[model samples]
Target: MYKDLDEFITEYQHTADFWYDVGCVMASEKLSKFGSEDWQELSSIVHNRPLEWQKKLAYCLDTSCNMYELEILLSLLNTEDEELFEICIDTLRSFTTQESKQMILDNPSILNRVNDLLPKAGIVSKKMLEDFLKKLNA
Candidate 1:
């Protein structure tokens, strides 16, 4: 769907409401087997882009996306870009399952932010909280 990660990231960064249903579908397809190559490519997109551009890409991550694309979004979230972290925290809150919550909590950098924001988003179970804490401790 995308010529390359840079081209795709650039488009998403510059386009408004870029993460439409069609975009999500394409992202899902591309990320079905997201691995080292894809991660390196996406990370390069984040590494080279400016903060504002990365912020827009983060907004694209906030869309209604399938699990595969969400995982790719999470991979992008691993970037040290603070803007991406902020947007990812918000996106994680939008998901209503322990699986999504657990995924967010697995990242130490985002865990506290997600926990702080989750209450406003909705309630999370005690077991989920314990598991997340355990994951961090481990």
Candidate 2:
């Protein structure tokens, strides 16, 4: 749809009510696909950009969050970047059980990635993730 992730961001990242829709479509088209130009390029945007973009990128993970992406998302809590950490927790906190189950089923082999993170996560991060996993079990 656009030349690169930045171009897509320029085109779609905005205050419109449709940003989530844009994010959902982008996740389906790009974030879920490993090694595609858009996929490979996402980490740079998340780290190098300002808070808005990072927060918006987190929104993209709101749906169809694969294990590969989830690993990175979970890793954000280990960062000193408060903005990144809060958005990371917020994103995980917002997930419903249906979404959690679907994500686990879709990426069953990587379920341990989430489990393994529990013990190493920071106190707040661990608490949030624990509540999250409980929903997964429910």
Q: C-alpha displacement of 89 in model 2, angstroms?
A: 3.0
Tens digits of per-residue lDDT, candidate 2, 54-101, equal: 656665665455554565565454555655655665576555557556
| Counted clashes in each candidate structure | 0, 0
The RMSD of every model to the true structure, in order and in angstroms, is 7.2, 7.4
The weakest ten consecutive residues by lDDT in model 2 span 1-10
* Candidate 1 vs. true structure, TM-score: 0.46
| TM values, all candidates | 0.46, 0.50
- Candidate 2 — which residues are off by over 4 angstroms? 1-3, 33-40, 62-64, 78-86, 93-133, 136-138
**Against the hidden true structure, what lDDT does model 1 obtain?**
0.54
Over 1-138, each residue of candidate 1 has an lDDT whose tens digit, in order, gives: 333544655566424454543554455455454565665566555646776555555555544544544575676666665546656544544465567656656666666654654465434443444444455445
Query: What local lDDT does model 2 show for residue 104?
Result: 49
lDDT of 1 at 102: 65
